[model samples]
Target: MIKLELIVQVHQLKKQGFKVAAIARKCNLSRTTVYEYLEMDFEEACRWVNELRTREKKLDPYKNQILSWLKEHPDLSASQVSDWLEERCSFTNVGDSTVRSYVRELRELYHIPKTISFRSYEALEELPKGKQTQVDFGEKKVRTTKNKWKKLYVIAFVLSHSRYKYAEWQEHPFTTRDVIRSHENAFEYFGGVTEEIVYDQDKLMIVSENGGDIIYTEEFQAYKQQRGFSVYLCRAADPESKGKIENVVKFIKNNFAKNRVFHQIESWNEQCLAWLDRKGNYQVHNTIKKRPIEVFTLEKLHLREVSYPLSFESNHGSSITRTVHKDNIIKYKSNRYSVPLGTYKPHGDNTVYIRIEQEKLIIQKTPEGVTVATHPLSTGVGQLIKNSDHTRDKSKGIKAYMDTVKESFDNSEEIELFLQEIHKRYPRYIRDQLQIIQRSLRDYGPFVEQALDTCINQRLWSANDLHDVSIHLAKLSEKEIPAVLRDIPLTEASSELIKEKASVRELDGYLRILGGA
Candidate 1:
């Protein structure tokens, strides 16, 4: 079939005294095909082409295979299918545009959706004043927010009853410290905190969930005591329960964000705070039908008043133990710091207790807790923190080396039990397994001791099993360090309070003595 314009051109060429063969050659068509259009009008040409163009397409051969693939993997995209055809099915000539068009038509014919749909939920009931507040985090990409396109996260806190909202923006993801600090600011913004606050199972707060049990993060568990409030974690996979905060996150992005200009993040935060005062909290809420500031009056009565910001203080005379390596060094937070050359005997029985005193690393002898070495804590990870005096006497005598080996294999109950169990259970491989345990101890120190105990108790047969257990335990130990003071119940208010207070005083006394020295 030929185009109407081509038919007109052919007739025009024929009228110019050109032969049918000449017209066919000039128009790039067969003489017989050119004759079909020579005497036809424009409408007749279009009708002729339309009549036969409905014939089968090249994709008809693989229609069944493509449909089966789409049904099995709804997420498989058109371009991906095209690439799959090129590589797997030898359909190298297949175009993405053709595939997409066919896929769209297939979707319409088969009732297959292009994307998954979620049911939108709206809150029907409202909790009483101070009974609940919702919390969540949101991210935004902004062009004017910084000198370049910047990605920022906003932590939003919303009162479920009053609809009062508090939001803080940061240039980076919210860390545990940032979460605690944001709560302080939010409470201050609302003038107090609710009795029970709802959360979206955020990692900064919730560590893990087992069935119905929720394990809060180590730092947040401490903050719960300091601030004295009930924590309400939303169920996993149930996003609808925390709908209020989610909407607040969107409201912030839309009203305060769209078409808005920003120069600095700090200035943006200040602007956000001002906007909340003038527009966010001040405006009449669509659901509650009252200003958040006015509704907060009733909620404020049940809310907890803040006397001080409840932030996690890492250590207060608390200690963490690490084993010294053969190189007269110990590992802490990805950095290695040196101890005295003879500090670690090959025996590996000795332990070092580190107290993070302000900005300094106070390394002390375990059991006695005597200050043995100190170095300013390293600022960067993967760095070697060294003290020249600690490296003296690298060339010790043979007897000294023998004694070093003897000391390492002594004093550890964990190592002793591991050897005993190895001898009783697998006497033939005892030497090899003992060597593995010693290697684990030299590398991981006291951290691997608990794992060895678990491995022995469980009768795990191989050295690799013990090593795996040790590594798992080491990770848990690291997670335990976002420290806060443990809360002891004050039954005897005066006496129990003194005990809690005493720990802080003890830390102070140690610091004072060190300060004098």
Candidate 2:
């Protein structure tokens, strides 16, 4: 038989228009059990529970021993009684449920209540106004007006001193950008920001807590840097460290969201804001014994003025995050687009933000919002839309290659200007261009100085042009070019060209060629 309290809750939820399945979910009961409970009235349920309570139990023979044990230890639980029976009683073939039922009946009949030990808490001194704010996230599954359930996510902020509260609700889980947006809204709602904010180690904002050296997510890091606020991340699994926001999260769920009909997320938020003004903030706090709104008046004076206006609808447009796959691709609308090859990492975050604008998909790196790739929005399903430049091997050290090429030529400034032009014109093929210049330095030797002058003066930014110019200069000086130099393929480009190859001619031959030139 279901307990009288559970039966009452089922009837209450049913009256609230909760379906049988929803009621079962809420009460942690099976659907069949809820159906049976709903079929019975409250009077019948009480009678049924009373009849079942008097029924004989498997452990009835040990009633005296069980009562003695309970008299000795008022704090012993049903599970503990079951364990004691298994250890002390021989051939006591009683299941845990039998012992649990018997123990409950005994406790009710004998007036022996289960003793609970409560932890003692000493209240810490209240923080000064504007010193800190605690922030946390909560989610609740609220029943929509249609009787369907929808889960809504919330990020709540509470001033550590004034206990003033601010909250925002969204139908979807928050992204890093969404968290930043909520922070802006909370700051605006509170009239200003606190000097420091406390947070749990939520992955939406924090990447890792590397032995107390906290690393925040990309966009959140940039936001914190821009907002100029200190962050204190509570130790994992320790909710008491930031109890103010924890209470605020629970309050939002129970007092505001519980049994509230969610028609739409926007209206729900509007209702929540109004509720805060009328009830949440205006009511006298139980602990502080002052209205939160009234306390906020003094706290507001101490708060730092908002550094900027709210930009919830900025030109940048809202974005959603997608994880970059091992193939350097992100899925959007059932299609895939590629980021740069090196964008994926095995251990760290591979997430990127995607924003749609003007019929195009803009894929950007996190935090910085730098565009990594862009493609026309695909209307077809399962299509792979990719930028060919993203396929390039970007892991090679382009800076080291540039440095090697620059040091080869005597006119470093001139070579630097030429390489910069190549980078601008052929960023995708920069490694190839640098490799060509390095090869020319090896084959043509000092003649490359004249080639650099030719390429820079004539605006010949192509590596092919540099190679050809160097060949022409080598010929002009009556130096015999090595057979390997003659055989080098100019038009064909490959990554193999970047690898260092042994010189074909001996040291004396290169010296003789340079001496002749």
Candidate 3:
């Protein structure tokens, strides 16, 4: 074996800028042996110099396999082929890396392909606080309960100055609404919006028809107005603006999402968000030389607060009904959305509007400027709606309204009798009229209904879950169902008692239980 003394001398001499010939003279070795020692790793060089050594035993086997693979795919590179072999076969004596070198030499002997040229872009030197953010999406192939290959998109945002990141999963083929909602949610998450949002010309927000004028869809523009931020599209095909987000997507995929197998998109999504909070946010940014939280705390202090009060309502539901629950609460998104307790319910025919503000549910009587009860965010799905059918009369009130909601062949008297019972159970003044309005809900789609069911069953019901579900449905492009559909029972056979206490299964049970109750 080549002695440790010789290896040390060679490295030391090289460090001091000694030529190979000079070092060989001092070491009493031939120039070729000295040069070979320099090129090889210390352990290997020592072994070679001490004795005439045969090649690693597994080298020849790997060489044959590599050549066979390369002959079929001649353009394959060293790293690519090595990775393929590592996964399929295991060699006791040789590392995949040892195989890599043999393949490199074989390619050179045949004068085969070379590494492709890669263009390096110039990077900005001095990014300032809150001035820029990088954004990008990553995707993973998932097999849904339907046994289809579904692609899940995750959007990652990194504030350039702080390296603070936010990530959320989205369905593929981004839509105008998806783009807008994501921005709004991100702003709410960060507690405020930065002045500039750096993005690629994702088709949702960009119009190619007018000289590539970056025209946000009307909804997106309204969202931007609500937050007061500007959108910056990157140069066509250039990814540098959002490089931070791009790198983070890969980092999260490898470190966090890699080991997890998800039954529903929501499960994966919740884990992803939790991972960002626990791991990514707390880790220090390599280039920034400071922790992201440290930078965010400082940057947040400098941002301008909104001058006027803006309503950040969910796309799902804002319309309200006048009926109040016996517990003095109103229901929205599976939780008890409360209105002001002392407010009076008017006797005339009128509608109320329910709005979400800063995570609180607000109910206002329209045109009358009357403020009703307000509730803090709810914790369960069943609390969002009660039996609103009891408020109206059977003979003159809820009897007619029930006819519209029941899907039946009856222009018949029996249907009217059923409506009469519904009206009688829920008096016209409290529950009946509200149930009529609740029965009329048809604005959201099936996927959301399923997602809410998941949330409720898992006991993870929150504004965040509802928000995430709405966004998730919008991405799928399914027809809208009423946001309050869950208030209605999935099957008449299910008892009111069991249905009333229904809990959420988070995302794990969503696929199985998605009958939309």
Candidate 4:
């Protein structure tokens, strides 16, 4: 194309009586095409030359803008720039082909100047089994209930030798808490530990950047110090250093998350785990020729035992605004948790640290780290509470029951009565039921009385219901007691009621006779 353009220019010069050899020397075209153009009529020659190069000149305007953008943002390539221009400015004259050609031309002109430097990655000569693992976050497209598309982040890990992969959807924000929790979960799932973990330099881990120095986040540094696991971070913007984990991320997303239908993030994660065990690890890898599970079994012996006792505190270090409601409940994550009255502003913001474990929230004073309160998982939008000591105490009723037992009967007699009563009441083995009742007594305190009352009223013994009700009582505030007790109708039954009812299990039968259940 360049030679043809030069030939036309040289031939035009020759028509003005310049020597063909001189034209060739100046324009860098061969003498042959230049002579042909010179022999042709001006109209025919111009038409032939334009046919060869007209499209390029036609897109010159749009191509210039694309070149300018690429110069401004060197990281952006021609196609990306073309898409941007197409959306924002509707650069009508340039197509993708033209943009590509212009980029090629620019690169040729400034080849040496625009070259990017990359550090060569060395292949691992031999990795001891379970000696190292690599971690990364992979994104997959998921649809919301409204059918809108969103990217879900999954944490991906790969064992160095076995190439065994583990992945789970990260339902929470990518925070230091999330990172630590993911590590714990992965370790538990793998049933072992690796000596070293290679990680991306996530912001949660790298707190600050000072030239070539990276300051680790306080939470991450604490974890490393306590756990005794060596940390290796990939160089900034270099993902290939952790290529095994990167490939695991791609494989899990494509094979597991992409193929499944899920209603919740947790459900998707669980499905991925099951799929990894059954379909992914069980199948022979195309390159490795052995099943991942088989390879992992061989490598498991090489993994080091977890070096230190595992104990973790929540990284609740966040700037939170305490929102107070009229009901004295502070809202978090669409559910209501209680705070001391007048400590928070109505419709205003105050900072607090909320340490979450599973679904439980432990609200704490920010600077002091003193536990202000703990809340069970909330059911709905609000809670009603009174200011009291933050400690959860449920021993009052149990102590009262023990005192009554002690006072009313001989020690041996009371023990025999309790055992015989429990054995007679339960259809299954009594020991499990006794343990369940004991746990409920500890958790529910006096509210265990209500659970007992529920059992007595229904003439049924249910350990599961006792446990569930105790948990429910732990979540309820003093204000909710009146309403809950009223709903259960437990306190006011008379001897007449007992005589009329015959048995607690018959209450439902009685209700059924009255067309209620």
Candidate 5:
């Protein structure tokens, strides 16, 4: 048996960069146990170590002998063994419970009996007044407006002390908003709230749980904080912990709802409430020998009255408020979904509430909460869904538009090669320079060819080089240059003129070719 200190040291040595074997050596524990404690988080390991103290069981002494006896005589019953023990052995103080417990353990270890066996149960102790309430939701098949069967939901709240109950029915499922409204209605019906409410791992509330830690849904967590009530969720596969509301649900269905037709949710609830007042609350004298409503009056002093209406809305609603991104799209689940043109105003306090339902994403403007756009939900992640009428799409920035305009120019090939060279050399200036090039093409027209050709001859990659060339092109677009400027000396004009390789041909060679060759 390992001491509790070894488990703590195993975790400590692992945190200090020790290998598994080294930690095992340091803690004097087997590598398997060390690995197990390591796999557990620090808090889990601490809890497991703290629970190591052994408390003796009453049947611990005879557990092994009972197993051997059951192995030899597989048909022996626990009650028969109890009678034999009292008559034969000196265990006269041993009651049937101790013998039965030992027999149960032996049967499990040896598998000597059938699959089913006797089980023990204890009745739940009733809680004090205003102490606890159990809540649960149930579904029933109902004939709907479409003249077909559909499932309607019922939420039941039952006080554990008095067995008094409150219930509401709805035509469809309960959204988080509907859950809050139902809670408000239930509290209003009881005229007060209990200190704690028990539930059965409801999805509207609990997302997941690990051991003692609970991860609640965002909306439910907010509701818990706002309502100022303690929450208790039954463990997985343990419905009996929240059995009160379960019984209320069954009672509501069996007695009031089974053979009855559900006309509509409102009328059914009105009729159901009247029935609860008359039959359910007024005549409940079974366990306590007093009416549930009469006992509920005594519990009311301990219960807290609803001081204000709860306004805590859950984010789990199909609709949620989200800030529009710079690209005029709202992001949900790592995907950028689109909206209509002008739906998002830059730097304005505008936001939109997005609702996803039935493969459709609805974008509604906030404050007014009007529907602005709708699109089919995309199947991929990190994608941009666009509407055709949307304006100023930042996803396709100005550079893509500039690419299209550049394709229309006659000198586009030379311009592309030049721009690629510029971009590779000075990537940071590409956007500014691309804008300048596009303006030259659009405003200066065919003269950009002259600018690009001049840039090619000068071996210059600067946009300034193109800028100077574009200025000259723009001047020439007005009219031809004056002759005085055009007829400069060769040396001076050669500096500014298009650079062509010089070629010399002798006149003597030409004359010989004409006559005496």
Candidate 6:
């Protein structure tokens, strides 16, 4: 028997001019089942569904036993019921769906509603000032100025002691580089770095966790070493360990990003910062019973001072060497600024000299000091500031590079249309978008084709959307998502760095606590 919801969906798709096979694929139903449902009218389909529900189910023999179990454990799930049946009665040959359907019928007939079990939690003791900060990521779809929906990603940071929050938004899924940049921005906003930072088991930072041994990604490992902060990764399935940022992530989505019209990434972030100033930080916190900004003022004293490399100063500074990434870009102040094409060498040194002078970022070739690129520095996080000319090869030109990217896909015409839409949306950064698509093809391979179809059908015109769809498809197929990895060893000092520190109290405070002062 088919679900009434599936029957209704079949009829709706048929009205929408979808072919039978396409409907089958969309609904994950067999052609025969679809045909059987398509032959019935709405009333006939309702009758058929009701008749099937009343029919004797395979687990009807143990109906009373299941009901008694539900009475004892009101939060028991269908899957658990099926498992109990197999274990207690040695039941076999019944499909999971069959058991699920029968359990639903029993619940409805007996008026036994499923109850949700809530986990009990205790309020943890507050951390000492500047002891730790928690980080988390969140994404939401918001209405653009054109009234179309666009997805935005945000990384949130919350100081564990004061809950002083800082969040940054982007138009794309964050890479490891983006995560590092956000960390820098968070530290700058808080005026200093904490002794330790807590994080979830995010792939951007962590590569794998075997037993208690944690393996961080190569880029994150380098950043961790440079920043001199300890990292405490929460165990898998335990987000409550770092519940501060989890609540902050929800607070950002609900209070700021919710119902907000996104004009552009830069402006959206500007609005978020303004919101933080007025409402998010200024308002009284429910748990701490004080304003975050006020608590942060005192907590700021205990924080470690921000450090920078001796090679360069940030404000109107002398040049410092920065490694050019494979995408012909270098990081400056949490944003990626572009360099000329072919600057990144696969087999040789790819370092370039960068400096800030009079509010402009200058990129020059090393030793010779020949200028390669220059741009006004960006104030936003995760922005890709590119010069169109820098992405163009003198011989091939931009059009030829676009064609080369499109030809790499199976459906060149569709890919061309998608690329053209991306060009229209992001005229200045079309080359970077195209390079992202090329990388997706190299990484996701054949899955990129399906992802393209999804993007085109849904009218998603960004490379990030295409990349996200490809990852979704890859996960659905149980295939491993490809990523860059290195065999960097975790040193003993870093491993031991995450141990919790004991808070010390003054003798005067102890005397007062004992009422003997």
Cα lDDT of model 4 by residue, 165-246, tens digit: 8887854445555677777778867777888999887766775555657677776788877767887878878888888888
Task: Give the local distance difference test score of model 1.
Answer: 0.76
- List the lowest-lDDT window of 10 residues for candidate 4: 385-394
Clashes of 5: 0
The positional error of residue 476 in candidate 4, measured at the CA in angstroms, is 53
Candidate 5 lDDT by residue in tens digits, 374-445: 888888988888776565444356458557756855777777788778877865466677777777767776
What would the per-residue lDDT of candidate 3 be over residues 235-271, giving only the tens digit for each residue? 8877866788778889887777663565776787788
Task: Return the lDDT, model 2, position 36.
Answer: 97
lDDT against the true structure, per candidate, is: 0.76, 0.85, 0.61, 0.67, 0.75, 0.84
TM-score of 5: 0.46
Q: Estimate each model's TM-score.
A: 0.47, 0.58, 0.40, 0.44, 0.46, 0.46
The positional error of residue 62 in candidate 1, measured at the CA in angstroms, is 4.8
* Superior candidate under lDDT, 1 versus 6: 6
TM-score of model 3 vs. true structure: 0.40
Off by over 4 Å in 5: 1-114, 117-119, 283-290, 311-517
Regions more than 4 Å wrong, model 4: 1-122, 144-146, 209-214, 307-517
Report the C-alpha lDDT of model 1 over 1-517, residue by residue, as the tens digit.
Answer: 3366788899899989999977887899899988888768877778876864566777778888888988988877888888878887899776777899778767778977767666876548778877888999998877673544556679999999888888999765565656787888788878887788889877667767778687777667888888888988888788788888989999998898755676777899999999999999999998778999898887888786887754233332243566677788888777899887788755324456777878998888752567668899999989988876566753344234334433564446655555555556764455556567567768777656577667767877566677788788888878776553345444567676666643346577887988963
Preferred candidate (lDDT higher): 3 or 4: 4
**Alpha-carbon deviation at 64 in model 1, angstroms:** 7.2
Rank order (by lDDT, best first): 2, 6, 1, 5, 4, 3
User: How many residue-pair clashes does candidate 1 contain?
Assistant: 5
Model 1, C-alpha of 158: deviation from truth (Å): 0.4
**Greater-TM-score candidate between 1 and 2:** 2
